[model samples]
Target: MLTAPVRTMILMVRHAEVHNPKDIVYGRLPGFGLSPRGEIQAERVARFLSARNADVIYTSPLLRARQTASVIAGQSNTATVRRSKSLIEVLTGYQGSPNSILVGGFSFYTPVKREGDESMDDVLRRMTNFLSLVIKRHAGEEVIAVSHADPIAILRLGLEGKPLTVENLHSVVYPERVSINQIVLGPDHVPQLTYFDVVRSMETAA
Candidate 1:
């Protein structure tokens, strides 16, 4: 006999724009908050999720992601947002200088140097571990997770069984300003991405 599959909905969202005008490549850097437009975007995202019934709201420890989650939770009338360091953005290989390159729309490519930061493999590990924990915690409920760009892409790749190499990082598209990716977690402990890069409408009247 085959075991029944667990039914859970995971909404993975990338945080709104940041306040970095110099484009200093603030990978996992502190003191980076959302821009003014990002605040509006976050509010719009909150309205988007207000229509859905979310059991729990989770956010990355990063300030921008946490702020985004807070706004959404407030709109949805959620009591509190859970913060997880595991959901943080990938640590970059470069610090002060802007070494990260944007490619093919929302895809980003960062060349690895000896004096930089974490590798692509490290990012994959962090993303997989965080997703595994989330799947185990919410077996049969809908959960929302707000995080950064690279990690979200990494998680999607992991769920799709794609290789986590530098070349293949661009396979998944990171949604702009509160885009949602829906994933279903089954009993086999694997997540299947149902939809990705869903643009939410800003108007509340709809």
Candidate 2:
């Protein structure tokens, strides 16, 4: 007898903008939180998630991600907000450099992979592992995960069978600040990108 597919719904969100007036690359750096505009963005996304009826929310240990998750939990009525290191930001060697340095590297034929920086493959592994556990735990429930830009892009690209290259990562339209990337996984564990919504200045993010 054919069994029904075990569908798992996940809303993968990128945390809102940081309060980085200096415009430096804050990779795995502490003391950075959401800016005023970012708070607004998070609020909009949170209100949007309010109607999603998500069961739980998993966020990165970073302050910005946690803040976003907190807002979502309060607004969406999602009771549980768990912090997962797997959702943390990508480890980059250029943490203290100007943001332009990293952004410019993307357009290069092969982006500079610093010696101490975390490999994209490693990122994919940890992210996928966390997702596996969530899928098993939640089963049929809808959930949310608030993470950073690089990690989020890497996970989505890895799941979608796209190349994990700097060019590809840069070319792919990333989930903007406080945006949602709706994904659905079937029993086969293959994820499908159902929708990508950017929370604009609208009263409601939906």
Candidate 3:
């Protein structure tokens, strides 16, 4: 049992590198796994989190994210990682096209077109709703959320009440391997970022 006001700590992490040779913006593209380097980075992230006391683990429904979460879970001996649709990467309007949306712009209103896709606003709303549910369900608990870059960035911006503009979106950079963002729940039940982009340092034994 726990007493006193408890703060829910959420560590939002970007998934490791993907297996995209041309690096064609494979937003929400299926059948893409992590590269070898990505696997190594995932292992590093796992090692970093294995020492912490995480109560729950949440991951995006994407393969890259699921693979990364699995690595961490294996290291921490945690079973049953939860999958959520809200954590999926941003749904770009253009799919299988070379002309993609520019990175680091935060314009959720700008409508891009893929054959069949949702708008940026729609994606943001769904992500926000999903985050709210997660926070309510896991209040005062330390959890790990492994998601893609765009969704993670959007979620953080939404929590801060910032407009999902292109500039603001472009400002978010995916941290190096095993970087952690510590979000502490305040008394008002709002999640605040205490630490952002703290990359775990390599161990140097004496």
Judged by TM-score, which candidate is best? 2
* Stretches of candidate 1 exceeding 4 Å from the true structure: 1-5, 99-111, 188-190, 196-206
> Which portions of model 2 miss their true places by more than 4 Å?
1-5, 107-114, 188-190, 201-206
Residue 15 displacement in candidate 3 (angstroms): 0.5
Model 3 has an lDDT value of 0.70
Q: What is the lDDT, from 0 to 100, of the residue 80 in candidate 3? A: 56
Candidate 2 local lDDT, 1-206, one digit each (tens) = 11115877878899988999899988889979999989988888887788888999999999999999999999865459999999999887668777787545552124445765678887888888877777678878898999887778888888778888876787776778887778788766456775455566464434
User: Which candidate do you rate higher for lDDT, 2 or 3?
Assistant: 2
Weakest ten-residue segment in model 3 by summed lDDT: 197-206
Which residue ranges in model 3 land beyond 4 Å of their true spot?
Answer: 1-5, 99-109, 173-178, 194-200, 203-206
The sequence of per-residue lDDT tens digits that candidate 1 reaches over residues 1-206 is 11114777779888987889887878777878899988888887787788888888889998999889988999886436898887888665454566355434432335554444666667777766766676677667788999877778777776677787666676566556678888777666455665544344434334
Give the Å error, residue 131, model 2: 0.9
Q: How high is each candidate's TM-score?
A: 0.83, 0.88, 0.81
Which candidate number would show the highest lDDT if scored against the true structure? 2
